[model samples]
Target: MSQQTSILILDDEPIVSKRLRPSLEKKGYEVETFTSSVDALARVRERKFNIVVTDLKMEGVDGMQFLTEVKSLYPDTEVIVITGFATMATAKESFSKGVFDFLAKPFKLGEITEVIAKAEEKINNS
Candidate 1:
């Protein structure tokens, strides 16, 4: 059997990470969650994650910057950007920066699950 996919979730809100962890874990992903971007970045440097789901707006190291950093450090890591402040420009920029998916806030768990499935497929194929 193949190894479990590793995922890192970064958001300023504790509830975001809290809500996503169990759901992704249940889907068989090896999940790590962080409320602080700094802490998350530190972890990212330590290990390669197959996927990263991160909030766009945060106190330190906003999602766009974090995405750039992750891509630079780990080009193969698939990134999904989730944002409360979703805009066409931001979404465009995310795509330009190699984001795998962009999800708006208040999304259903099923939506994320679908996206995760897609990411998993890509990882497996790669």
Candidate 2:
């Protein structure tokens, strides 16, 4: 919390978390990852994060639902939605619900990094 750079990564795939954690940590973010939305929600309730990056296609609470919950519970927390099933509908829905950014799957690491940078800026300003 306190507006320092920290990221919470919510992805069911171990591979995604594995690839992303080191890069974001190297950039100086305090990082936490969860493969379960239930557990992530508990963590979110207990602590404030600079950003929350969640996969859109999860087994329990999918990304869209997660986005809604995040905004409702932690309105100031920036939420980035990432999905392999990228579509116009999903993009529109995410924006309508106030997602910070949307990233289609197969996106380069730099692209996600840019989104994280933007989130940091927003957090700092707020």
Candidate 3:
């Protein structure tokens, strides 16, 4: 089951991955986390992830660009944007680019889990 759903999480902070990886993996998800957008972008090009969780503000290849690329490569891949700098504009922009959801920073773990479950259902349906 874990092999069936691959998730890639990208954030500039190591702690974000540290906190998320274990929780997600414990739920039988194939989770991979990276602190560098460049590396995450490279990985995305090589393989497919069922869901992508990314931070909008990063040094290189910000979330907007990253999500755009992911949608182009795999239109069905669900993207959830998480950022400390969330705003109405960013949320609107993300939706315009076909993101699955938008969450602000410091969200509860359960919030993400619920959203991921929704994404999974959508994926299975598609």
Candidate 4:
């Protein structure tokens, strides 16, 4: 097997993380899912992930703050935002922070996979 793409998924809801972890791992990506942003941030500090998928809303350290820190630590790492409360302002703000993509909640698995494919392509090309 080839080197697997490492991904960190952060969502407050356990169901969200549970649902995504298996699918992403099945795609041959190394996956870590976190329901807590604090733990997620600590994990990121220890190692850099190739891609990060985060929810816009969370208890501590919201998605914007999380992504900002990720970019600072590893500017090349691609970030994808998934939000239940998607808004134009948030989308624009996310883009300005250099997020690779933004997705609304209740999306199909295919949608996220497609975005991951694109992010992986960019990672490879870079």
Candidate 5:
């Protein structure tokens, strides 16, 4: 049997994790959601995930730092940045820092799924 794709989701809002976990799981991913970036980073240290979906603004250890750390530690792990406070600068920064995709907040589920699909393809190909 094929192994399930493992996904880590980090967002300060509980509702975002609540909503995304099941949807991603339905698509055959092993999804773990976190409202705390610090805790999520701890988990990331414990094991590598195939993908990480994170919000840019958080109380501690914001997305940019998290993205930088993750890319440095696990270059193969694909990261997708989601932020309500989307700016061209932030988007450009995310891309430059090596995020697989950047998503603006209040996004549709379909949009996220599509991005995940692309990330999955990359994971499989590599």
Candidate 6:
């Protein structure tokens, strides 16, 4: 496996990607940010990513739909769902759908780094 990993960050809020992009890039990840799931889905079809990090709620396409689509098209790409509204139902559903991870909002840089690192490791191993 290559040391260089590609990660897709999908969120309607620019700040989520803004804050995450630099941090992940600094960790040596090739990161792409999409403000819309529609655009992100197009990109996903074009290129293969090691992991996809997405917000659970968005204006047009919700995270669950995005998650389902990504899984259907790219089964190898791991997904991490992040949301401010963390509920038991969401957690159970995401896991049942084989989501890579679930992160609530207000996550620190360190926490995200750890999760990404873990996911990357899993992908590399697989």
| TM-scores of all candidate predictions against the true structure | 0.97, 0.92, 0.96, 0.97, 0.98, 0.95
Best prediction by lDDT: 4
Position 56, candidate 3: lDDT: 96
lDDT of 3 by residue, 11-57 (tens): 99999888889999998889999998999999999999999999999
- Which tens-of-lDDT digit does each residue in 1-126 have in candidate 1? 989999999999898888889998997999999999999999998999999999999998898999999999999899999999999999999999999999999999899889988988998898
Better of 3 and 6 by TM-score: 3
Off by over 4 Å in 4: none
RMSD values for the candidates in order, in angstroms, are 0.7, 1.8, 1.2, 0.8, 0.7, 1.2
Superior by lDDT: candidate 4 or candidate 5:
4
Q: Between which residue pairs do clashes occur in model 4?
A: none
Give the TM-score (vs. native) of candidate 4: 0.97
What is the C-alpha lDDT profile of model 5 across 48-126, one tens digit per residue?
9999999999999999999898898899999999999999999999999999999998999999999999999999999
Pairwise lDDT winner, candidates 2 and 6: 6
Q: Quick one: ranking by lDDT, best first? A: 4, 5, 3, 1, 6, 2
How much is 8 displaced in model 3, in angstroms? 0.2
lDDT of 1: 0.93
Taking all chains together, the TM-score of candidate 6 against the true structure is 0.95
Cα error, residue 67 of model 4, in Å, equals 0.3
lDDT of 4 by residue, 1-126 (tens): 658899999999999888888988888999999999999999999999999999989988998999999999999999999999999999999999999999999999999999999999999998
Which residue runs does candidate 5 get wrong by more than 4 Å?
A: none
**Model 3 TM-score?**
0.96
- lDDT, residue 85, model 5: 98
